[model samples]
Target: MNTLDLHAEEFRQQGFTVFRSVLPPDQVKLMRNLAEGRYRACVADPPDRDTLRGGVSLMRAFEFGTAFRDVLALEPVIQVVEALLGDDCHVISQNVLRTPTGRGIVNWHIDDALFFPFFADLNIDPKHVPVYSLNVMIALSDVPTDAFGPTQVAPGSHLSGRRPERSPDLPAGWEPVSLRAQTGDCYLVNSQTWHRGAQNETGRTRYVLTTAYGRRFISQRFYPFINYTMPPHVLSGAGSRIERLLGAHDKGPYG
Candidate 1:
């Protein structure tokens, strides 16, 4: 198997894996500028700031700029995501996180409600674990140390099938791993994995472009749940892969 396949297997077994130098330094700068600009705009516009959770971020940020939209299609990141969740995987959510000095997603928690919860006494095969969704984090800034507040994941936590909050106990032989990366690195994570951003004290902002992918059976979370339309300009010259990533889907099972 090649490096990406190994990385995919690592993602399956360890709950996450990082791909180094996925984007060029210049491209990282461009995306970082776009993200910071979006954050600043959100700050001025009270409505946009509402997406800011424990960390500074904007949900569905790809809708605003082509640079952000381009991020969703970066091949290195998609390779691992598609390998784990299948090629039919499409974007479930695309958001950006920017944490400056003294601020980060300090709370350790799962991304959402447990997707495949099981009992402590249940015997399960690690290979049988299903991946329903994915989290691909594209780091536009360097996260070389704990002080930079890189993401931390419990190795194999997804298979534990227990929320860190409720269980708080590691499955035997599991340990926490801090996902530190250089600028332009991309990391693939199972959404079920227990994770959180470590505190940032580097006096510089940590910029991460986050994209979530789900299997064909899962629905795209474009929000509003009613009549949200993808802005035409964003898809002005996109190809088939980007369109699919942007929620363009052919008929699938149970449709």
Candidate 2:
């Protein structure tokens, strides 16, 4: 069987899987340069402190850049999310990470909590809230196994049903596994999985782009940066209907 078939099975069992060369190396490099240029330009101006809050606006508007729309069109990443989430699944949240060399690590955490905030008070069934169906992280640069930390995750943690609390040390049963890869590698993780960004001490910028998709019935948080002034071509292949649903500029019934 092909990689997609293998990845699909792995996702079902482990709740996540990594695909090597999901995007062509040349394309990944081009997109990375385009995105980095936009980020640098934005940072050249006074920084917006709120942008660091780990919100959708911060990730999509500032980091992903217009070229990211092209990346979203990649067959492997798109097909995997669509296969897992069903055809109507839209881009709920797109992210870009620009970790400067030698950055400190972030706390271990779960991605779904950002959407399903009431986990602590789920007087009702937790299933009612939209948990992330799939989370895709695409590496735009090489993440060496030895340096410039990549994402660390606990394999099969999605089955736990309970989110792990923050701790300086790993709990007794959990093992920290790093998701390292070269440019064009993509990691598809279930929203239920536990993961975190490892620190980058290698003196090189670590860049990655990501998108979270949910079933069609769910709402999209933030997408299609309001500051994006480019024309349709920038997001052309994303399809008008899908773009409207996934993007913020639309004013139709979904809007």
Best by lDDT: 1
Poorest lDDT segment (10 consecutive residues) of candidate 1: 165-174
Relative to the true structure, how large is the alpha-carbon lDDT of every model?
A: 0.80, 0.66
All candidates: TM-score: 0.90, 0.77
- In model 2, the Cα lDDT at residue 217 comes to 63
Kindly list the per-residue Cα lDDT of model 1 for residues 165-209, writing each as its tens digit. 534344466666889999888888888888888879898889888
For each of the candidates, the C-alpha root-mean-square deviation to the true structure, in angstroms, is: 2.5, 5.1
Highest-scoring model, TM-score: 1
Question: Candidate 2: what lDDT?
Answer: 0.66
